[model samples]
Target: MSDDEGAGRRPKKQRPFWQELPVLIVIAAVIAALMVNFIGRPYVIPSQSMEPTLHGCTGCTGDRIYVQKLSYYWSDPKPGDVVVFVGPPSWNDTYRSNRSSNTLVRGVQNFFSYFGLVPPDENDLVKRVIAVGGQTVECCDAQGRILVDGKPLDEPYVQKDYPWVAGQNAAYPRGRVFAPIKVPAGHLWVMGDNRNESRDSRAHTSDELHGTVPVDNVRGKAVFKIWPPGRMGPVRSHDPQSN
Candidate 1:
């Protein structure tokens, strides 16, 4: 057992840092892509529209939600499930109107959005599903409540700025007088918990498909609020009717 014996066995060579760096980077890219495209990704709430359920107003850091992308692969987005989706063209128009006009600035924002590092796509929005395809949805029934399939939804999560003042038409215009409209096939009727501020399905009724969003546009279901520690918890799924 001398140098002559060792010479018979080739010495192992370690990979150079440069050679290994590319592999490491590719592996990381793959993992990040998989998580963002298939597993789950963090979405920052960018508006106060969802309120108490999700904060995004001035002076309040937005709530960060983990959207489970796989949830819809097994089943469709059901009524009462909170979800995120690509905004309709009309929505995008409105959102883009206020964003930076410079292409460079937008490029940076888009890059961050791709990784879930900043708020989701400026065109993405989160809201609760009030009714699914083929269901009839209307607001108010002498009680100023939202109804699905003629049954009042048990929505304890709704955040109203003022007390329900029944018979006050001005206070509940959009929330109270919506005609019983049927959701189209492969579409969803979504509304924000903060009914008063959200520009959801109700605001786009003039569109060709009324205000219902195409199911295909849905990104994922938000099953948990994972930010601000104190507010971290499983998001509640409401029942269509009160027991």
Candidate 2:
């Protein structure tokens, strides 16, 4: 057929790269948001609370972790799961959102947050579930071990123990101590591996919730450590009570 005769069947011209880039970015952002919100997400440890297991400290790159949101769809977080959760109101006494006050800047930050370019606007923390709903938790028996349901937890993951000091009238050296606390239904008692420096449940016992985190606050279970090449591996969720 002559060139003129084939003109009507010619393929359409493609859009310029600049013209399509925005659309491509939006599409990519949508996919990432869905994955983060429903399937899983990557989080950067911001503190040393979960030391030895998941490393992070001021001026450190911190361990980037993968949190799986799917498992909890059918099951509640139990003892041993390394979980990411929002700090309850009383637990956020020192937390301040870094989101910009400018609406446009905040929107941009929010957009980038889906791609892990910026942090979330929540006081998300990582800790191990020491006790779950309807359980009694307390610290220090004859030995310096946390007791859950009146049983001592054999927690090998604890890398550092809080320093011991004599109470005003105590007969012996003691670390932080609290009376047996019955965890309310639908809540959890979580703590960090670096007991010495971690301001976890033990530090918040005086709060209204008595340092118990609501199960609803749990974001997901931390399943893997994916940052700092040498430390890449599965994040352990060892059940201290399994023994």
Candidate 3:
């Protein structure tokens, strides 16, 4: 063929849609998986872990928080982050295995609860952050004072009626000072606003562990309640050290 004829001839075009179909589908699947894993996740409050701060209605109904999985990307778990984390060692009955069959079923129930498929359960306790790591969180003083880092923690989240007393227990005693731990490098000392009822770091990790929680265990901070229209509000970081 002459060079002029060759130049005039057009090259056959390669079909792209079919050739790229498999790769495109794989990419799409990966994106979907990432979204489900990180972007937005659904969780059910299965027990009275947090109270007052959040309440459950039934075997299915309760308050919901849209956890910002990426929120911590720019920051670390702060002192006042109302967080949803998997429980560690269980000394009291309040601890629930996040992976157990019961909780798994609860997750499924929560999926349908939004559509009125089931009643919301009050098992999940929605409480405020009382004390963070490194700070000294004491119950009550001689008169009545809850101190954090030698300064009193003005806890308005505690049950309005049941007032907080220092070392109320004879063993611990009222007005007793709870020593402060440096919070370690990656640990946290979490407490429920409902001090008396919450079996948090104060009880479980005390003595042996001194209520200090490892930072790695934290899942995400409770930023907002997305369920039940009545209790809608933003979850602020009460911890001053969450810096």
Candidate 4:
């Protein structure tokens, strides 16, 4: 057939945008998933545990943070690094689901969580690392300070300490008193800046691991606060031990 006859028989037809939209969406989703799983992910602070460092208040918009997963592959978590981790089994003993009870609503929330729109359904928590493997940690020297390796930590970040009510709990009558615990290797003892309000390692010392979280359970290091225009800044990672 002649060139003109052949061209006329094979007319170019552009596909409608509606037909291409799904392909584009699927591609975008795949890229987002890879980044969230391997590179880093966003997390919303769920409580006042890390107050002053990361804010989370009930009935209010919590600070959204960017957690870097790449760093831990080369370096283990250090003291004072704010981290997000899966709670130890004992930590979640009274945990309750936050997702809607409706099946369809829960399913929808799960789908958005993959893209970091909603928080994960698991019992994930955030706290500052106070002591690492092999360190002896305890609370309340005469001046009321946390000790690591027998050195009192000068923690200026702890602005609010929960007060000890007289006769509340005999074991912790001084509010932050705990017997010196030699942290097990490969675990971390973490706490919150809001000392009194936080339920941290000190609260779970009776557990099998003695309230220490395994390093493997840490998801990532919280590097920056990305939500709430007024609170956008790097999450503080002060090494209290250095002082």
Q: lDDT tens string, model 2, 1-243?
A: 898889869698999999999999999888888888899889999999898999999998999999999999999998999999999998888998879999999999998887777888999999999999899998776666778888899999987875544453254323367789999999999999888768788777888998999998999999999998999999988898777
Give me the runs in candidate 1 sitting further than 4 Å from their true place.
1-7, 16-18, 97-122
My TM-score estimates for the predictions, one after another, are 0.85, 0.87, 0.62, 0.86
* Candidate topping TM-score: 2
Better of 1 and 3 by TM-score: 1
lDDT of 4 by residue, 103-220 (tens): 9999999998887667788888999999999999987565667899999997889888855455544655333788899999999999999886898898899989999999999999
Each prediction's RMSD over C-alphas, in Å, is 3.1, 3.3, 7.3, 3.5
Q: What lDDT score goes with residue 185 in model 1?
A: 91
lDDT of 1 by residue, 34-143 (tens): 78878888887888899888889867688888888897998899988899999888766666543457999878876755565555444789999989998999877667
Between candidates 2 and 4, name the one with more favorable lDDT. Answer: 4
Clash pairs for candidate 4: 162-196
Which pairs of residues clash in candidate 2, taking residues 3 or more apart in a chain or in different chains?
none
Per-residue lDDT tens digits of candidate 3, residues 1-243? Answer: 899999999999987998989999878767755654466444555445466776653475766676657876676676567776655545325533333268778787765444433543323233344555555565455645556666655545555224435456455532233544545555666766555555666565454556665555555667787777887887666554322
- Give each model's whole-structure lDDT: 0.81, 0.87, 0.57, 0.88
lDDT of 1: 0.81
68: Cα error in model 1, Å: 1.3
Error of 1 at 83 (Å): 0.4
Candidate 3 Cα misplacement greater than 4 A, ranges: 1-29, 57-60, 90-133, 160-182, 239-243
Off by over 4 Å in 4: 1-14, 102-105, 162-175
What's the CA error at residue 132 for candidate 4, in Å?
A: 0.5
